[model samples]
Target: MALDPAPPMLEPPAGDEVARLRRMAQRQWAARRDLERRLHDGAALRVSALTLRLGLLSHLHPDEARDLRTAVEGIQDELHLVLQELRDIAGRLYPPLLDEAGLGPALREAAGRCAVPVRIDAPDERFGPDVEGAVYFAVLGCLSDGAATPVEVVIRRQADVLRVLVSGVDACDAGTIHDGVRLLGGTVALGESPAGDALITVRIPCV
Candidate 1:
């Protein structure tokens, strides 16, 4: 009775595999920052200058050409809209607040944009950019989209580990959160809160 050939032994991930993931994460962060800089310094600046020029042209136009003034003003309005959209895109790509104010302020700003109320409990202290970015995006990803249910977010640092807890959100994509956290040598778990809300817990090591 040879019991089913004893299931094959499972092997842990190789060191090279972990290194590759770290490299990939670094590249992604660099690319996002570069793109955000270009949008802010290049495209956004150019659009803003064009809008100002159009405004000046409208003002300098003679009263005889009322049609031309109206056209210039219309163009200025469109340019303004474009500038706003560019800034929004840049913010989404990589928020400057994260770099300047650390994780707490950045998360607060994001929470302000949500339709439902979000309560946050995090320290104002700074952490490595990779650690902060991973935790910020993880929490942001778990936020309820268009749901009226309020969310509760908590962040704490213990010795060398950074822990994050999110509750009151339902239907979260745990796989996506897991992938993001795993790249930082972290773990993510899905559970239920005392109030019966879906809870997500994340732990990442940081120096």
Candidate 2:
């Protein structure tokens, strides 16, 4: 029997396609920046001010009797919890250290917040803001997946590419990470390590 002819192959994308992709990347970055600005300058600041005002209620009646003082203490405790939650939200929106310090410190701070212990090995080298932001958030999503497995993260630079490896955490937001990396003209691979640990590898060009 004669085999049918194969389907025609598609041509590679041209300059227009590349330009469209660049525009998409710029939009994504602009959205992230807007979110960070709103959280830092709007919601976070309001929450902090509210927390301070609630705390000052105790100082307003410092000479009150024991029972009143006890009531004020309870309110202060609740406000403290609310402040913690607000800080967590701010962290999720955009980690301050990620912008101020860099990727390494940001990852370490994120690891410290995880329920399971995480060991991170990252170089001091810095990349562009968009590149570092994408890499850091990818690992952050993995760590925030509510898994109890200990995590190990290693970040390094290979020539003009920045490499990030995350293992031992399940349920990472691989799809989201892939979208972000794609915008940066990068690649992401997810699989198991030799010892069966959940592994995620991301590579983004530093050009």
Which prediction has the highest TM-score against the true structure?
Answer: 1
How do the residues 1-207 of candidate 1 rate in per-residue lDDT, one tens digit apiece? 566775565764687577777667767766786788898889888988998887787777777468888898788889988988887887777787887798889999999989889999999888866777777887788773554688988999999999888887764656667877898778988998998888888888777
Question: What's each prediction's TM-score?
Answer: 0.83, 0.69
- Where in model 2 is the C-alpha error above 4 Å? 1-27, 30-38, 41-63, 115-117, 146-150, 169-176, 190-199
Deviation (Å) of 165 in candidate 1:
0.5
> What is the number of residue pairs that collide in model 1?
0
TM-score for candidate 1: 0.83
Question: Model 2: how far is 176 from its true place, Å?
Answer: 4.8
Runs in model 1 deviating more than 4 A are 1-16
| lDDT of candidate 2 over 1-207, digit per residue (tens) | 998996675864576566577567757655665687787788767766876776577667767756666876677677668767766765666667877788889999888878898999998876766787778877777777776777888898999888888788773566767876787777888888887986888888776
Model 1's alpha-carbon lDDT is 0.81
Reference-based lDDT, each prediction: 0.81, 0.76
The clash numbers for all candidates, in the given order, read: 0, 0
